[model samples]
Target: MTAGTKPVGTKTADAVVIGGGIMGASAAHFLARRGFGRVVLLEKGRLAGVSTGHSAAIVRTYYSNSITLELAKRALHMFENDRDLLGGDCGFRPIGFLLLIGERLRAAGEHILESERRHGLHVERLAVENVAELAPPLSLDGVSYGILEPRSGYADPTRTTENLVAAARPWGLEPRAGVAATGIRLHGNQAVAVETEDGTISTNVVVNAAGPWAGQVGAWLGLRYSLRWSRESDLLVEKPADFGELPVVSDPGLRVYLRPCGEDRIIAGLGAPKDIEPVDPDDCDPGLDPEMRERIERPLFERLPALSRARHLGGYASLYTITDDWHPIVGPEPGLEGYYAFFGGSGHGFKLGPPIGEALADVICGETPEIDLAPFRPGRFIDGEPLTSAWGEGNRG
Candidate 1:
């Protein structure tokens, strides 16, 4: 229907990427660039029109683990080179990233800081007083220390995803929008084709980048992916004129993330809270509710007093496909050939999409990913090796 999608049925592809979100589009782009043939991407709606469209789209590498940190770090590179390498402007703004932790998480934050330093990243462990220099008119009443990554910032999610689809076009990626993948056609254990509403596309490989709908896709193959959905909401308000510019701040102590929305607005959201509201991905209304608005305003006001004077702007709610360990499940599914599980973003899907997509594409092509993906394999959960984190943080993957 939309000019972006193709009528399926008779078409066959070397690999079929489901979901047109950042994950799927990123995977398709990398797969086609890697010389995979006839890569067709299927999306039920418009590109990046689901959760990715609603994502705050923060890009940072402050992780509690090395694996995700590596992925996030590489993602920054891809975003930086989007125009030359990824085929379009990703709208990446390298303002900065700030992480605030209380006394309870100081030791854990320091541990992660050490790992970041070991990886040769430029980060600084700042005392509480220094936090004021990054975000002015803020409260550090309960904060103990902060970690700053000046090279990290945010991107436009919809543009980045659409650019990925565009980038893959010349490389033979056929993205079919408004076409839902009904099921997976399997021959024995090998995924042979994807059954779509338009028709069947014969394929050997499939990437489940369905975000909140990934759990449903996994069921088609008789695979039970340990996935959960949470309603995450974010709000934007007119930035106080004097606020000028501010670093993207993630305060676990306040359970909020604050970032600049262009030059005139500020965006705020609850950061990796454990009291996740389980919701049905297909049925729930994804809109920021009044109760949630109050929940966000309290800390946001206390953290940045100047923001309270800004005009209130609208905001939205979206789904976070969370896994038990709060990290994503990327890699081949056990006993399922040519099928890779690539969802379960927990909450950090935005920045990790490109790198994880590249790595998963490598795994599917029988090449060693620059980074080992064994730690993110789905089998780890069953093997009792669920990826754990320092401080037991929720979304600081």
Candidate 2:
């Protein structure tokens, strides 16, 4: 784990993780607990120092795909009571989430509601009056309907990742920070170890959980994928001097979402046509401009008239690795034995980390996963399969 030491002969491990964010940390945690004792987790920087630290930490199960929805539901179950699985405080907040829909998507709203009900999600379809009664802040004149998830909420992504790493340490896993993966060592077309910037660690398998930089990692093994990175800025506005409780809210028509960070601050983000390519993952600006704020503020003001009283403190950029359909790229990579890639989660990975890690671990051990992973195969694109879906949030397959 030394920063500048010469590469040493690595002690073989059962599995090696290439990133230290929530995905890698949770994967390592599950692998060790599932009887994979020789596990090593490598982080290019400190654990949760990059995208995971800046995550909006929204936890919702409104996915259009059944596999992903099941994964989110399972992970939520673990997070809802982390004391049993993670063995410490994971900072899970139970604040509700309200998703506003426009007139054009009323059918989509009902379809999602019915699907949630079938899965026992307990979500309710709300009229404008019900929306106002639940949130009591937003202007609902333009909204046709809304969905209320009483069990959905947010969490502190950084703390959750660190807590998982801490829990795995006792199970004989080593999480080494400040080590960057430069390449992969292959034996008979299967990854056997990862060569880092400083040293090489020999292992039985490698898990590509690199978050925003996952595509670069995939290239190391010559596995072609469609993962691409983009930057979205969010304005963290300080609450007004007398601001009251504001639940986490999403407006699909406006492509914007906001949530209360604490008693005195609110976090806001948008997915719009103005999205831009990210320049650098580490140095991207975290501040939002007046024009961008206004773009988000206009719809927000209509939804929450009370937010007009708050002051904009600043904004920051969070990187997203989007695929053609925005569904996560999990499971094994095509033509690469002994390796699994998990990234391009779009913006939903934080809440799905626990289940993703568990599924990856199950694959490594030759066990059938609890949830079907047909929707996340890397070969989907090669076989002329479209990454098409109801939600147009495209990501690497």
Candidate 3:
């Protein structure tokens, strides 16, 4: 063992969690709380130092499916009272999320409203005039309507993840950082051990919360996943005082969104194009492309004209493991018993982490999840059924 590292012994645990992002860290915390002792959390890099650190951290319940809406609602509740739920403040801000729709996405907005109602999530479809009322400076000349998720907002992903990690520490769960899992050792169709760069760990139940590297981890256990990777092109602009009060805004037609950070900075991201390369989750290069900036700035300038004077503080990239369906693949992989995988989050993993972590802990402990996970199973693809995209015509524009 190096320094304070736990010595390698034939230590057996009820569970071993891989990847210390929000997903893994939350999973470990929930597992320990649910009476699972000897839980171990392993991370290849520093905890919350990967995609979790680079996340835009927006939380919204706007969706065209009941499941996603419920997931978001539950997570929103947790984030709102994180001090009680996770034992500390998670720095949550309820700035609300405004989805501006064009004529093309009106139907999608309607569908999402129906689903939101079924899940008891309170949202409103605002008229163009009412949208202008929410943000006086926004130009609604070409906009159709707005889907206002009143209870939704944003948080600091890094701070939330670290807070969760600190909470897990007192629960008797040992978290090992800077340990990378290289492969898995199997015996007769069962995963017996996890091979890491530093050492080997013996465990039967492994939660592969590896985020972008989830596919590679699956392959180690002899399973195939049709997952692709992509990079999120984000820009953090330091806005003048006048432009800082806007709520988290999404213009689906323009394929871009912006959320306020602190009092003077805002984080922004452009929607993924069909032709963009599936990025390596571990390696991200953030650069400014003139065309991309032009496309991103069009709607931004129209909505918040004063932002034209904002200085670009450059950006960072986040790796997304995506499935053909935009919804994530959660639960145990098909043909791989005693192993669980959580990957293909696309970009929604951070907001979904808390609730999903609790559900995952319930699943591992042989309890029914608070939310039905059948829709998010990893085996959905084999049956030629994939979760349809919930983003409507509004987003398509």
Candidate 4:
């Protein structure tokens, strides 16, 4: 079931999932794994060919909320045991995750540490001296402290999505790459079939995980999702031979995050809480903007001075489908029977996707999930229950 092998012609299925990013791929995989029968995943492009592919792919459990913390914990387990749980290697790197706290964010950082400690997650509070020992390259000038997640690091985003789809192939999961879902057919408020460019798929259950296009997909059903789009960018710099290994680092003072891409490259991106550059998903530029280099590298250079001599290995931009609350909208829609909304990763979708998708399958099958997803329901925004974070409005959730 290689990508773009063929179109999925008209057929009947137990469930049809829209979008082939990590969310859709993971949902389709779990549904099929649960024996839901004849699950189909639709993608307008190849799997992980959009935002997921361009993700920083940081996998850490430093969340302020219980639900996200739990999901992130489970996601770490899945990536760690990818062969048994995810059906293949997901390129997980266990170099650890470090969050640098400045004097201004000290209180918020303490709150997050307390929350993680109370939830039984492995975390360490590091002083500036200890932080220097862990990451020698980091300059902790304005930093007050640091929180280290010893078991967290990152994984390959593209490989993860592809492996999920490949793993579910034997379980009756049909992945249709290059096939766009144009509309959803309903009967008396229940989804009956999904209309696509190649054909149609008749199914009782439909999951909208359509990333940036989720708004348009919901519009087909007369449902409106308040989603905004931003052009997020990341840059890669060639690592110097003498530069030693480094862990995934998030510096709040600089508003940037950096992680090792491979043995010879470092990937850096602007952190959340910055001004949003609104963009249309379809017409946005894929190449990184010229001005972004200074924004991303200035902080990166401050943290790792050795990179000053490193070569610019180019970069690219991608879309971040953001919700007003900066958290994802998941779970079943109240009025839309058999239809669920699973888009809006905001900024941290890569690590949470598989675990959330697994739990979503459990909910769809009428079984209690390991982690409760009620906090992420689609109606939370309307019901005035938007999840808040210690970091205020950002992807720090």
Candidate 5:
């Protein structure tokens, strides 16, 4: 594995995960817990070193799709009881989640509320008064209605990834940090090995959970995984005295989303009518710019007028791995026996990772998955079955 000294000894494993972010960590965690022997997780850097570490980490359950909604519900369950499942704390803050839309989408809002109710998500339809009652600092100008999930909130992303890995340590989880996957070694239409920077692992299955770098990894196996990278930025400001405790709020009318960062701050980001702001995931400015901050703060100020007194401390940007359909590319790749494409979180992945990993691990371990993942198969795009959402916004899906 040194200079041209031959690859590190051919170590065999049941599965090789090529990223240590939340998705890869969760996948490896679940795979090991599902009894996959010798599960190896390869990370170029430390766990949650990239996007996961910078995630806003909002845990919301309202989604236009049933699969994502179900997974989100399950994720909430795990977050609420991490001690039982993950055996640790994720620092989940259940301050609730609110989604506000313009007057034009009132019908769509009600439809979504009914749809979510039918999907087992007990979300409440809130009028403007109710919205003000929840977050008193908000000015409901140009707002039509709101959807509230009382149990929804945010969590610590890095801790959740770490705890998931920790819980699976007793189940043969082999986490190889600082080892990057160079490529994939295929054998007759099947992924049989994972090529690393210093070694090659002989494995029947390889998960492309490389986050923003997943597109590059997918190309090694001749797989055309349609993925895009967006530089997602968020800023945290000092909580003004007048700004009361606010829930995670999504104001589609103003194209902004914000949540209480902690006791004394609020984190804000852009919402609908998004600017793609594509960038090279490996090399991009991580600092938030004034222009971007203005885009995030304008809508924020429009909704929460009282926050004008808050001071913008600082913020950073990270990559969002988006797919063609915005939904994650999961399950097996067509014509490939053992390769699984599981990246492209599209900014909403932080909360969805655990449930997705659980189901995908079930697939890899040949067990009955609690939820159906066929809609998320890599071949869905090619098979003309791309998933859709009422919002039709990339991340909202």
Candidate 6:
């Protein structure tokens, strides 16, 4: 049977989540686990086929704000305990993460160190020598120091989304792949159902986790979200035979972040705090551009000199649905009773989606979430309380 076509004659559901990316899958999983009967997840395409699939799924807890730091910390826990918390193995690699601190980023790094420590997160301040000892492949030319998260690493985005949905299947979670939500049916000012190309499913609760297409989804309900789209890319190169294992490295000085993709390949991308390359989410090129490849590789070669002799293995591009504050807009929409806004991850949504979804599920069930999500309220933008970041105007929150 096609996804979401189960229980034979059911045309109704307790909740409907739009977009099958990590955010949507996560929301559906938690809602179903909470015993919200008949939770349906609607996807225009395959699960994690859009932005989530293309993400360089790095999971870390380094942030300047308490809300994000808490959310990220929860995410790390969920990933580490995936079988129990997330329903299955999420392909989490505990390869550690290293943030190279240079003169320009020392102050921000220090702030992150202080914030993370205050939250009781496991973080260490490593000097230049310590960094070199941790990753012998790195050059550390302009690096002043480093911040290390020993448990932070990357995960398989597609696998993570699939696992969440699979874990929730027994609890009445219906995943509707290849189904596009065209509009939201509202009674007065509240969402009542969702209209899709296949058919409409009557539901009281609706969560918008549409990633790059989120702005368009908001318009269906007369809601206007200030979202911008950027084309982000990541490239992989064949790892040298004797290069050995390396931790996920984020170098603000070189403006690049890289990690081991697998046993024989390394993946790299431009770090946050860079210029946003605006794009039409539907029309943006999925293949990495030649110029961008050069830009990403130049820094990769500088950091790990051995990679210069490695072969280019091509790369792909994807979209980052950005908000003005570089943070996700979560929680219930103000005037809409059963509608929730859960998109706009900026650039770091992959790692934050599941934990935020779990907390959002708690909020929807009229219970208090372990991590308060008040800071990410949808109306924060209009209230003139946009979140500030150490690296201003970038996705380094």
Task: Identify the leading candidate in terms of lDDT.
Answer: 6
lDDT tens digits, residues 134-234, model 1? Answer: 67667888899889998888999999998888877888999999999998877778888888898878788999988888989999988888778888888
Over 1-397, each residue of candidate 5 has an lDDT whose tens digit, in order, gives: 3322234578889999999998999999988987888899999999999999999899988777788888888999989998777548999989899988678777667777887788787799888898888878888888877899999999999998899888888999988889999988766787878888877788888998998888889899877777888998999899987556888998776789898887898889998546688999879799999999888888788888777777889999988888887888888876888888888888888988889998999988888799998988888887899888877665554
The TM-score of candidate 6 is: 0.97
Tens digit of per-residue lDDT, candidate 3, span 117-147: 7788888889999888887767676689998
Query: Which stretch of 10 consecutive residues in model 1 shows the poorest summed lDDT?
Result: 1-10
Per-residue C-alpha lDDT of model 4 across residues 1-397, encoded as one tens digit per residue: 3321223565789999999999999999999999999999999989999999999899998888888988988998999999988879999999999999998888889998999888888999999999999888877889999999999999999999999999999999999999999988877777888888877777899999999999999999888999899999999999888787789999877888999998989999988565688999999899988898888988889888889889999999999999988888898887888899999999889889999999999999999999999999999988899898888876646
Global CA lDDT computed for model 3: 0.77
Compared with the true structure, all predictions reach lDDT values of 0.85, 0.77, 0.77, 0.90, 0.85, 0.91
lDDT (tens digit, per residue) of candidate 6 on 119-146: 9989999999999899999998999999
Which residue runs does candidate 4 get wrong by more than 4 Å? 1-9
| Model 3 root mean square deviation, Cα atoms | 3.8
Error of 5 at 119 (Å): 1.7
Regions of candidate 5 where Cα sits further than 4 Å from its true position: 1-8
lDDT of 2 by residue, 32-118 (tens): 889888788989889987678888888887765577778888977887888777546778887887878888767767777777788
Worst 10 residues of 6 by lDDT: 1-10
TM-scores for the candidates? 0.95, 0.92, 0.92, 0.96, 0.95, 0.97
lDDT score, residue 252, model 3?
A: 72
CA error at residue 41 for candidate 4, angstroms: 0.4
Instruction: Write down the worst ten-residue block by lDDT for model 4.
Output: 1-10
- Between candidates 1 and 3, the one scoring higher on TM-score is 1
